[model samples]
Target: MAEPILKVENLKKYFPVRRGLLGALRGEPQRFVRAVDGVSFEVYKQQVFALVGESGCGKTTTGKLVMKLLEPTDGKIYLEGQDVTELRTKEEIKAYRRRVQMIFQDPFSSMNPRFRIYDILEEPLLIHGIGETRAEREELIYKALEMVKITPPEDYVNRFPHMLSGGQRQRVAIARALILNPTFIVADEPVSMLDVSIRAEILELMKELKEKMGVTYLYITHDLSTARYFADWIAVMYLGRIVEMGPAKEVIDNPLHPYTRALLAAVPEPIPERKDVIKEIPIKGEVPSAVNVPPGCRFHPRCVYFKEGLCDKKEPQLVEYSHNHWVECHLAGKI
Candidate 1:
């Protein structure tokens, strides 16, 4: 494989939990929420590497850590061979952020309501000092707007975000992220807030941009089907750790971990001809709290294949089965 454009090794984030007044008076020790714990992955240039899991599974937190939106408790984040986690100065961080961008889940909230579409798109270039003159800024802004298919840029340029539809607003968001011509983008559930009818359109637009602009993406989402369709590589996270990861089709069609199988099973079946097919509930319990994670394998409490003393007593490391397929379950192949 080629060298990764971005890499995260042993990434960890622990948000401290404050104690109540009584607990503080009693001198209780401080607690922490292990939102993201020891997540490691690599994204090669122009590849869409997806992190998929249920809510509170730390996939979003992992994305934020990679984008430098949140500092990690312990880990290393490398962007184009530079360790961004070590960058402390404003100039260093500013230079590093120019190559990395993020498309948030909520399009409405991501953009400022006070600014015109043109201003929103031009802000990045101004901050980066890309366009010196007004004409240059306008040209870049229009080009970016057209890149996302918001044509007749003149009409949309003067208008505010409220005048646009949800789909159009998302396109503007994409344009804003692209105006800087970033090498890598972290799209955190980009299409989750859009209407189902337009979700495919937005996804296809992003895929097109990836090919046309040679931009790699870290697609964070909980939808397994979408991940299977949009990502080149898939990593299934469970309770702050990657339980499984491999090529998209191999992981989706031949899932090895119990948690992965459960996520796949939860996706609504689209086969209308197979109405008689019986579905099995793979997982039984709720996800555990991050502050008080299970002792050993986090999935043991809800896994159907849980063993008496083994799974509950030992934490399994991600082991390779086939060429690139990796799973963290003890019975990966045996089951």
Candidate 2:
């Protein structure tokens, strides 16, 4: 796969839960919230590998871990074959950050309202010491703005975050990420907050950027439809675990895991007959608390085809069912 730009193995992030005063007096054991648990995946150079699941399924947490925004409790993260997870020195982290960039979910929240668009874009280059002179920085800023399709860059360059629409603000965010000329990007639901029509425009811009710049993307989204459209490969996540992964079209057209099938069924279909053909696998009940996960397979409690003994007692390993297709489900081979 052209030597993966990023590789994550058994990544886990656990947030501690403090006990109450009384429990502390009794010496209660520390409890942890497993935000991301043992997630393993790879992003090949220039490939858009998406991690998708319902909100709080650890997709965003996984993205943060990959970006090193959150320190993992266990496992390793390798960037360009270097073990970035253990890099403690400031200079090492700074160098790692330059190669890997993140595009947050909320454009409004991520952007600084106080700064002008030019300042926002230039800050990264200045921090990274990319362009030396004012003229050089200005040139890079304009190029970045234009790269994200904010035409006649000068018009939008001096404007503040409040001056632009949701979509325009997001373009600026993307431009900021691209200014560093990063090889890998973690786009965490980049289009979820924008208008429906504007979402397509932003996604198209990302696709173009990948082609022109050879940028690899870890596109994290709950929207299976958009994942199907933008990603070269798709990984179906459920309860902090990847239930299925394969080529985007193969996964969408012929889903293997029950959770994957359920996600695709929820996506609105255009044709009436096709809609009927797509069975709606109603995911009953809420997602189980990560602290006290189900016994065997995490999805067993909510899975429709779940058998009492097997699914509830045996954890399933991700196994290859066909060429390039992998699924983690008890019924994968049986079906």
Candidate 3:
């Protein structure tokens, strides 16, 4: 296999827990929220790799770390085998930004409401010094809009973000990301805010763009259904750790980890024959706080097959169970 376009090794991000003055006076030990605790994944060229879990599972933080928006607490990130953490200077970061971009979840909020669509699209080009003149920039902006299927760019380019529909706005957001022709894009639940009917459309467009432009994606979302459709790989995160990861189809079809099975069981099936056929992988309790993750397996508290000592006394290491399939559970294949 070819080398991965993006690689993250044991990536960690720990945000310090805020302490009030009284607590500070007591000299209590400083605690931290282990948002992204020892996450590691590799995204190949043009592949859509998804990080999926419940809200606050640190998927977004992972995306930000990849995009260089947030600094890592420990570990390394490599872009095309170059250590991304080493690029700290403003010029180096600016150069990296040109090769990497983000497609935010809320398109409207990410855009400047006061700026017209054209200006918004032109911002990246200006920062990167792509086009020498207004005419050249306009041509590139129009081409980007066309690439995103927002044809007749003139019709929408001059309008404000509020004027476009949710789907159209999302297309514009994608267009903005593409304007610089980034090598990797961090799409943070790009379609969660859109209507269900439009979700497939946006995903299809993104997939199409990948084929046409060779852009890889770090797709962050909680929806398993979409991940099954849009991603080539899926990593199930639980309390800042990946519990199961493998090819999208394989993981969805035959989940080894109890947590992965439980997640799949909750997904709504549309076929009449399978409508009530929930797999019923029993899970208990709410997700534990990130500030104090479970001692052993993070999902053991909610897992149905958790063993008393084995699952609670020691953390499980991610191990390969099948062809390219990995699970971090004490009873990965036992269940």
Best by TM-score: 1
Score residue 270 of candidate 2 by CA lDDT: 80
Off by over 4 Å in 3: 271-281
lDDT of 2 by residue, 1-335 (tens): 37788889998989898789999999889888888888888889889999999988999999888887888999999988999888988888888899999999999889888999989998888888888899999999999988898999999988999999999999999999999999899999999999999899999999999999999999999999899899999999988888999999999989889889888878876886566675556677789998887889999999888898999999998888999999999898565
lDDT of candidate 1 over 1-335, digit per residue (tens): 68899989999999999899999999999999999989998899989999999999999999888888888999999998999899988898888788999999999899999999999998988899998899999999999989999999999999999999999999999999888889999999999999999999999999999999999999999999889889999999999999999999999989999999899988887679898887886999899999999987999999999997989999999888899999999889877
Model 1, residue pairs in steric clash = none
- Residue 144, model 3, lDDT: 94
Clashing residue pairs found in predicted model 2: none
Question: What's the lDDT of the predicted structure labeled candidate 3?
Answer: 0.93
Question: How well is each residue in 1-335 modelled by candidate 3, as lDDT tens digits?
Answer: 89999989999999999999999999999999999999999999999999999998999999999989999999999999989999989999999999999999999999999999999999998988999999999999999999988989999988999999999999999999998989999999999999999999999999999999999999999999999999999999988889899999999999998888878878876778666664654788899999988888888888877799888999999999889999998887787
Could you tell which candidate, 1 or 2, scores higher by TM-score? Answer: 1
| Model 1 segments more than 4 A misplaced | 273-278
Model 3: colliding residue pairs: none
TM-score order, best first, reads 1, 3, 2
C-alpha lDDT of candidate 1 relative to the true structure: 0.93
Our tally of clashes for model 2 stands at 0
